[model samples]
Target: MVQHVWSVNELGEWLAAVRIDPAIFDLRPDYCAGLMVVAGISSGPSDTDSDQWLQAADSCDIDLDDVHLEHWRDAYRSFGAKPNRTRPSADALSRRAEKNGLPRINKITDTYNAISVLQRIPIGVENLDAFVGPARLVRADGTEQFDTTNDGLGVAEHPEPGEPVWRDDTGVTCRRWNWRQTPRTAITDTTANALFIVDALGPDAHQRAAVAIDTLRTALATGTPSATRYIDTAD
Candidate 1:
C-alpha cells in the first residue's frame, strides 16, 4: 500500500496555504471554495462505486440556465472568457450525465464526479504526488506553463492574461478556474493522496459547498479514506 506521508500539521498547513486572489472575491462576492484534503485512499472502482456514479448521473437535472450554473457563467464572463464556448466543469458534467451518463474514470475521480453532478457543483481532484507546491488560485498573466493533451499528444499551453486558474510553483494545474485540468496533477488509479475542490456561487455558496463536502466525505467512506482537513475559503 502506498500510504501518504502528510502529517496532520503538514496537511493543515498545505491547505491553509491555498490562496485565492482578492480580486476574485471582488468580481463575485458570493464565490466560495470548499477544499478537502484526503490521504490514505486505497481502493479501486467497484460495483458499489459504479452504482453511485450511475445513480448520480441518472438524477442529474442541471442545465445552463440553472441559477448556480449561471453564477459560474457570469464569473467566466467577468474574466473575459465565454461560458458557452468553454462551459464550467459542472455544466459539462451535467450535460454528459444527461446525454450518456458519466464516464468511469477511477475510484477517486468517480467519487468526486458523482458528488459534483448530484450536488450541481463543480469539483476538481488533484493527485498530490504530482503537486509541486501548495495550491493557489490566481488570475493568470499568460506566462505560466500548463501541460495538457491535444490530439492524444502531450502539449503545453498558457492561460490567457487575467484568466482565473489554480496553480502551484510549477505552473497552472487547472485553467479557467474549473474548466479544464492539466494532466500533470490529474487523479489516476494509483492516486492515494488527493485534494478535492468544490466550487460554489451565490449568497448561499458556502452552505451549498459544505453540503457537497459532506456528501463527498460520506461517499469516500467506501474506500480506505483518511481526510486531513476541510477548508472553506468563505471563512
Candidate 2:
C-alpha cells in the first residue's frame, strides 16, 4: 500500500517530524534515542535468519549486573516507576531470554528484539501506517490515551502525569519510557513501512545507540528495500 509507494521526500518529512521534548532531557541528561524508518520491507513470520539471531541473543551472557540495565533501572526509578515490577524493554527481554527465550513475533519485530538484547538497548518497532501524526517523545500530562491489552482483552490506559512517553498525534505509543508498548501501532505481518525507536541511557548513551542503530540497519538490510535513520538525543 502506502509503504510500497514511499518516496525519498516522504521519508525525509517523516524523519524530520520526530522530536524529543527538552523537558525530558531535564530529567535524564544521558537519554539518547535513534529513530529509523524502513520502507518496502519484506515482513512476515520469523524465518531462519531471525530465529538464529534470536537464539544467539539468548545465548549471550547478560544479567541484571549489566551497566546498561542498571542505568535503565535508575531512569525508571527517577520517573517514579518500579523497575523491579516493570522492567525496561531490554532488561525484560534479556531476563526472558535467560528463562524461556524471546518469542518469535515477526520478521521486523524479531530482528529489533534480537538487536535490543544483544546491544543492551531498549528498542521498539511500529507500523508506520498506523500512526496518525508525527511521533514525539515527551513528558505526558496524563490526558493522552494509551490503547493496550489487559489480560487477553483490549483495554485503554493513560500514563501518569509527568511520565516519559512516546506518542503520535493520537496517543501514547509507549509508556514509562520503554517499559510497555501500546498495541494500537504494533507491527504486524503485513506491515511494510516501519518506525524503529532505539533507546540508550547513562554513560556512552549516544555511542551505544549509534551502535544499535548500525546493527539494526545491517540486520534489516535483507528485508528492506530502503532504510532511513535519524537519531535524536539530549544536549
Q: Give residue 16's error in model 2 in angstroms.
A: 0.6
List the candidates' TM-scores in order.
Answer: 0.91, 0.93
Clashes of each: 0, 0
What do the candidate models score in CA lDDT, each in turn? 0.80, 0.84
Q: Candidate 2: which stretches are off by over 4 Å? A: 1-4, 222-235
Q: List where candidate 1 sits over 4 angstroms from the true fold.
A: 1-4, 222-235
lDDT string for model 2 (56-175, tens) is 998998876899899999998888989999999999999998889999988888888988998888999888888888899999999999999878999889899999999999999999
- Cα deviation of 129 in candidate 1 (Å)? 1.8
Top candidate on TM-score is 2
